[model samples]
Target: MPRETDDHDDPTRRTYLRYGAALAGAGLFAGCAGEADPVPEQTETPRTDEPGTTTETTSSGQAREACLFPVGCREFTDPPDSVTTYNMGWADMVVALGHADRLRTNRLTAPTLFYDRFDIDYEAGYPALWQDGGFSKEVFYELDSDLFLLDPNLLEAWDDNWDESDTAEIESTVAPFFGCYNRRIRGEWQLDLGYPEQAPTMLESFDAVGTVFDERARTDAWLELHADLQARIDDRLPADPDPPSIALINGGSAPGDGEFYVLSLADDGYEMKPYRDLGLVDADGFAGIETGQYGLTDYETMLEVDPDLILVHWGITTGSVTFGGDGAFDATQFREQFVDPMASHDVGSQLTAVAEDRVLPGPTAEQGPLVNAFQTELTARLFYPDEFGVLDLDAPLDVPESEQLFDRERVRDILAGDL
Candidate 1:
């Protein structure tokens, strides 16, 4: 299902109290210096689809069947020389296609970030060193990444704060990072202004990054996972399953809990096509409000419609729903002060979905390979349950043991932090 627009700018909102620390508690990151280059001339190339036999040797001399980002000493002959990734989505996607040797390092549990672009809760099953506390440190320090594929929002924030020293440190130590599109850019100029029926959906995102990383086939396979999952989901759902007449709360609670931004399949947000694909029908009188990041909705109007499902987009950093706190971002403050208020409405709780509690929350941004697939799978399963066989309704679906970032909680804790 597609996610509703923000009630207000929550991602940029301040959540937890910013306790002044001396780098000891959160383990402040210190830059890593450059090492011997792995691959020579770095260039974007398509992944090899026609399977061929080849062996990749790690720096440690031990080379097992490399799939995704393998932990321990490793090296790559790619553009950035040697690199590890923090985003579990990236790790999961990479390893799923048997290219583990291409990268190294994984999530080192710490704390959650302000907003989760990719689902982190599902990666805690395995052990990773880094987690929350810092934004992208574990990924930066752990791996020898030459190119960092990140959401555009994150990239903009980093670009604003990054200095020559930081760049030099990363380049000398690891490699240059690449900015990945997140479908959430400024309204003045950008595609997919957080719309359920606009450009840059997960499918488009996979195609975009997959092109840059030369992992198109891997990406296609990942995308194919969604198709398979969705088909199964469709087959399982009631042939005449009622369309979830949904109205989503922007960043806070539904006015009458009668809003559904859109139908959600993969926790990313809601996409209309998926619903139509599943043969779900909706009322034509439903109104959709577009307000940039904040999906300023007509709450009263929603109550009149009495949608069947209510999708509340909650996390941290929605300015409109701010909690007077001292931290960078505190979801509890927002939840209690703002989000909780909306929860009290009789109709809000009495709506069809409210009675059934069909509330699904998702992260705002981030489109890591595996993360995208997980979202797609989760959403597909939710929208088409019978065919999909009751998938684990969670964010960042688990990658197999052999795949990297299998540890679910580690990723979740890391996600608890702010952007």
Candidate 2:
């Protein structure tokens, strides 16, 4: 649970050595829907930097630059006026920085759900870009954007997969690319596509984006708030509580469908933060299950491990459907389909989690800073109700001002440029 935001809950690349050869054969490719959504467009480029060094401010002192995995060092001449997001995570990051107005396009097919939850609306007169399907190079060129906040590897998942060449063209001709979609180690497809083995932490990615947008001061402020949250969470870790072994899975909307998409909790990524920070044991990883990059398993195999709890991850991608239409978060539907079906199944009923109704719905896998904070808080309340107060899933949190995990006022002020 989280406070009703005046705004919202809210809230990459390397190997640059062969830069020239990559650009030579760059050509148009059919777009694909590899991310949670698609972004608009922008124009700008960057200069290389030696690894390890972080920030690189321009000589004019107007711009700031930073680096993360995969994308080496990229400089921002000034804050980007327009940006496109390949997924909701990046969109949330931009919104967290008070630049939702800068978004050229995005992948949010259901903007009403998000905008209502976060209490943010794009500035009046700014049109929205919804990538219900995949996006193309032609659209990028037409948009003439100032920045592309997307993960390059996701382009490989597209119908006309973008290679290193296409990426180079976009950087040289359009705006520089940032962000990583493979942070969550879902299955083996990412391995074939050469997704980064190690993804940056949520905070690390935020810091890098903040630098590129010349929003470090605001980023720092948010970081401080997150730090306070971590402190509060630490204080609430129940003494000697049985840390439940949980299986993290992604399922479809169908009940009888045998789809069980389990993510590797062992791998380091932002998606695993809630599990890790709250001290949940990884049932699949611990059972030595050979989980592929994005492989699937039948219900029979899943019952072998018999985890103490089942955490269903939902609302992660644009392909994901919110049952019952706009502004709908159907817990009843979730229980009837995802939780109950598995629990009632002969194979699944034997599991400890199922017997106790311990299966729980998790936050959207495409979480950013604000969402992460809320998810973490929810997890804490769920797992340690005695240590942390009980949370009403359907209602906003009632944390007092003194006990607030984050400074909402600070975030609003920062977004409004009042700080």
Error of 1 at 411 (Å): 19
Q: What tens-digit string does per-residue lDDT give for candidate 2 at 152-241?
A: 655644423446677778889988887766335333334433333334456656767888888767777766767777777877686676
- Find the 10 residues in a row with the least total lDDT in model 1: 65-74
Q: Stretches of candidate 1 above 4 Å error?
A: 1-92, 95-144, 151-154, 157-174, 183-189, 192-224, 230-242, 250-287, 290-293, 296-301, 313-343, 346-352, 360-381, 384-419
Give the range of the ten consecutive residues with the poorest summed lDDT in model 2: 1-10
CA lDDT, every prediction? 0.37, 0.57
**True-structure lDDT of candidate 2:** 0.57
Model 2 CA deviation exceeding 4 Å by range: 1-53, 56-61, 109-118, 123-135, 157-160, 185-198, 253-255, 284-287, 290-293, 315-324, 396-404
Candidate 1 lDDT over 211-321, as tens digits, reads 434443455555455555455454566756765665544343434343434323222222223333445444344444332234344445555667665544333233212
Number of backbone-clashing residue pairs for each candidate, in the order shown: 97, 24
